[model samples]
Target: MADIIIIGGGIIGLSSAYYLSKQGHQITVIDKGDLTDNCSFGNAGMIVPSHFVPLAAPGMIRQGIRWMFDSKSPFYVKPSLGGGLPAWGLTFLKKSTQRHVEESALPLRDLSLLSKQLFQDLAKEPDFDFELRNNGILAFYKTEKAAEEEAHLAKRAIELGLDMAVLSKAECEALQPKLKLDVLGAVHYRCDAHLYPVKLMQALIKYLEQKGVKIVRNQEVTRMTTNGSQISSVFTGTKEWKADQYILATGSWSPAVAKLLGLNISLMPGKGYSFMEDEPQQRMSIPALLCEARVAITPMNGQIRYGGTMEIAKINSQVNMNRVEGIVASVPKYFPDLTPAVPALKDIWYGFRPSSPDGLPYIGRSPKLNNLVVATGHGMMGLSLGPATGLLVSQLVSGQRPEIDIQAFLPQR
Candidate 1:
């Protein structure tokens, strides 16, 4: 059995550990933080197979340019003096083409579908319970123009074999009678599932511990010692742990770790904010996305969670109130009857999603080093794609054929 060490204890790292341990590999996971709060815990808890379109799609450049100056815009890229930033931005613009979108749709859809199945199987595990709900997701649009755009996308999704239904305003209201929405129409994707992220993380950690996986929390991997092409040991302050293999699953901070090995990976931190209300009046039976606002609302374990905003800033954990207020403003727009009390500044939680230039994550082995696999760059889909990625990582490590074609996710291709 190979002694493997995984860096980063986020959902991706922990999930990889879970799968690798099950395959009889001795595993140790290290993280800088306590692993209690991060992107995996603060995400919009969506198992979305319908989100096949990558972020760097056609027409996004114009939209991003229009929203560039707006502080509370759904997507904002903070202009900076960094050298790599311009190169990444240019590459992102170049990939924002119809051909690229068409090319990416199939791989993203396949991975998401595989991930959905894995999540369903995980729900059936004896001691695993994280509020898995298959009530589906509704993407609501307020204007006729927005509805038309969504309808076009829905048709493409349907062509890709997704269970999608376009609903009129009245039909959408019938599904959720409480939400008096002011929307022209809605697109319902029945193939989606929702969960409570915090609950899921806690349950998975507990399950892994019970199964005898060594979880080393609060330990940061400072450096890596390599002998020729193989990594010899991982250094964490005073401790040196030797491993036969290493998996890099660090989220937004992955680039820094990759730099230690002289690997050039273009990953930016897209920060997002979210908050939970103690007693929210707007109780949703199904999760919904405010299409224009780009906000996601999930009914999780008796409380409502409002999550949105994509600020393309550097990896700083500062909570911008203006951005948080944007998410709060969107709540009443969708659920008019619900008036959420303004949360205190301290109550709002923010986490960085590791975004790639072309919206596709880097998931395969690094060509520079043998026995070192990279699994970061899931961006906003980290929670949605965690289990499937873990399974794929295990397959690669064990010298078995992967379930999906990993050419798109290759570290160097």
Candidate 2:
């Protein structure tokens, strides 16, 4: 079996390690931070097959411009002048076409379904409890205009063979009888699911450790030494780690890491935050996405997690209070009976998503380095696509064919 090294200990890297180890390969995972800390730990935790359309869809450019001035907007691109943002912007604008969304839908759906199945399979394994729930997710709209637009998207999803229900406000409230909903209508995607992200991450780390996966934490990969077209070893200042194969799963930092290998990958960091509190006074059985507010609310493992905002900017840990406030403010508007006590600013968690220009992940082998495989850029769907990507990585490393077509997600794309 191959000696594989996975960079980035988030969902993608951990899942890759888990699957590769099951194939009897010796796996080593390296992360810049401790394994306990990552983007996967604090997210909406939704396994969303409903999200077939990529983020760079038609009319997004217009919405982005309108949100530019609103600090509390769900999507905000912090004004910046340099560091490849201009190039990424141009590519994003170019890819924001109807054709791109249509082409992306099938692959996204396939990958999400595969990952969801894998998640279900794992839920049955001993000592693998992570609060996996298949109750589905509700995407509710407060205005008729937004609800009508969602109906159009729901139609597209239905055409793709997804199981969904366009429910009236009364229907939504009936589904969650214990809570009151303040929305015009909702679209329930039965294909979607939810989980507790922190529990999953913790369980995976423990299981991998038990399975003898080497996890080196707090060691940042500074550079690599190349021998011809292959990467001989990756260095983290004091030490060098060598493996038969290397995988780049370092989400937002992918572009910077690839720069060392002379590959200009158009990737930027889109930061998102999630704050959890004890189950609210009014509990909802299903997770819901407030369409107008751009916030996601989930009842996870007896706790309520409210997350939103996509701040496309350079990677940093600075917390935006306004953005956090926006998420909390929307909670009351959607669940009228609920009064969510906002978590302390210090308690909030934020992580940068590795957003690609075209909104599809950059997966597959590197053109420059023969032994290196690129597997980052899942963006908001990293949690939703993690296991399927891991399975694909194992296939590639084993010199076998992937179960699904991944042409659109190749690094060369």
Task: For model 2, name the residue pairs that clash.
Answer: none
Residues 160-235, candidate 2: write the lDDT tens digits. 9998889998998788888887788899988899999888999999999999999999999998889999999989
Clash pairs, candidate 1, are none
lDDT of 1 by residue, 135-247 (tens): 99999998888889899989999999999999998999999887788778899988898999998899889988887788898888888888889888888898999989999
Model 2 error, position 7 (Å)? 1.0
How far is 198's C-alpha from truth in model 2 (Å)? 1.1
Q: What is the C-alpha RMSD of each candidate to the true structure, in Å?
A: 1.2, 1.1
RMSD of 1: 1.2
| Model 1 misplaced stretches (Cα beyond 4 Å) | 279-282
Name the regions of candidate 2 deviating beyond 4 angstroms: 280-282
Query: What is the TM-score of candidate 1?
Result: 0.98
